[model samples]
Target: MKNIWKILMTITVVAGAALILSTAAFAASDSKTLTINATISARAELVLAPTTINFADNSPTTVSSVSADNPVAVTARVRTGKATAATLTVASANDLTSGSDTIPISAVSWTASGAPFIAGTLNKASAQSGATFGNGSGTYNGTYSFFLANNWTYNTGSYSATVTYTLTAP
Candidate 1:
């Protein structure tokens, strides 16, 4: 009877220890979700019309007035992103030269229209210059007219000069 009671007490103590140890260990769980984002930007593009300008019916005769026979028209097409204004600049390759004599670019007068160049008045420049041709810019088009004066004294032999137009956005 004594042995049985001792063994029974041992088994009950072991079972109680196992129950305590099982309660000591625990399980926990949590869950969450994640999201990601990205973006792309738009690019600006500028295009010009009539890549070349040609003047015709130039007079070589002696004259006292600026003959306006040859007038060439130019236009621009632009596309911009989040820009409010743009500029167009005109440049001459070099002065019209013959031997040692030179004719400055001032001889060519320019006129602009569509909010900057005024519709009817003409603008003249002595060298390379720029003007605002667009406003509130998304995509816009503008026009310009150029005329070469016919009154200048020089040795004549097919005088020529190159002109360039550039556009900028900001």
Candidate 2:
């Protein structure tokens, strides 16, 4: 009887210890919170196909205006506020020049084929708007056909000029 009682007591103690350990193991828990953040800012991109354009000589009487690389493909991408406006502009470095002879930059004008794009003449003193967008975060595609007014007064020589295109998202 004493031996049996000892064994039972030992088993009860072991089982109680195991039950307490298992309960502690099951009840133990730890956790930490995590925070995430994301940010988007204003951005702009402009692309032009055939960065260089050439004008072929023609009779001033027969042709009132000369075409130079018609239908220049243009792409604009922008990211801005929903109510903010995105703008694209072009500025001429200088008038078409061959030595001392020159043609006014204003003589060069373009016709646009796209919404929000407007027809405008090249300007050396000021930037000309190529396109304007009321909505934000979009890709706009368009074409610009350039024309130079042909005049008998122009000095005949290879003439060239540089123009810059700017896209702004604000």
Candidate 3:
């Protein structure tokens, strides 16, 4: 009977110690929860007004008269947003076509009032090497003058070319 009591007491003590250790290990840790967020902004944009330019016919009695008053003016309004720098470029080949016949782009030239460059000849290539309009923000109203000096005789018909103006924000 004495041996039985001693064995029971030892088993009870071991069980109690294991239970206490398990409870302490589980209670030592903690947990929490949170949230995250994000957003997107607007990009750079440009707008041009008076997209059309029309030059009236000038009757030249002499080559001097044609050369004297060959220049015509056109105004353009540029409105831009969210930009660092912008450039005004034109097509290199400013050609006027009728059926199978055509006139060369170099016959006409252009000059801008507030442009940061000297007057440049129009062409039919690409629109990269034109002129620097300016930098920063807001709207800019600029006038561009086109001139065609009558050094040679052109076939008598309608002579016109569509000029494309591109405002690139870089």
Residue 71 miss distance in model 3 (angstroms):
8.4
How many pairs collide in each candidate, listed in order? 0, 0, 6
- lDDT tens digits, residue span 1-170, model 3: 99999999999999999999989988876988877776533233434344555444565545422331333333333434445555667765557766555667676766656545346777777554445655554445445566665534666666667766565555
Q: Model 3, stretches more than 4 Å misplaced?
A: 1-50, 56-84, 92-94, 115-118, 128-130
Where does candidate 2 stray beyond 4 Å?
1-36
lDDT of 1 by residue, 33-142 (tens): 88888763433454555555554444557443343333334444444445456666666667666666666656666565554533332223423444554554554545
* Residue 54, model 1, lDDT: 51
lDDT of 1 at 110: 58
User: Model 2 — TM-score against the truth?
Assistant: 0.78
- Residue 94 lDDT in model 2? 97
**Highest lDDT scorer:** 2
The Cα error of candidate 1 at residue 52, in Å, is 3.0
Q: lDDT of each model, Cα atoms only?
A: 0.56, 0.90, 0.57
Global lDDT of model 1: 0.56
Ranking by lDDT: 2, 3, 1
- Write down the RMSD of candidate 1 (Cα, Å): 9.4
Better by lDDT, candidate 2 or 1 = 2
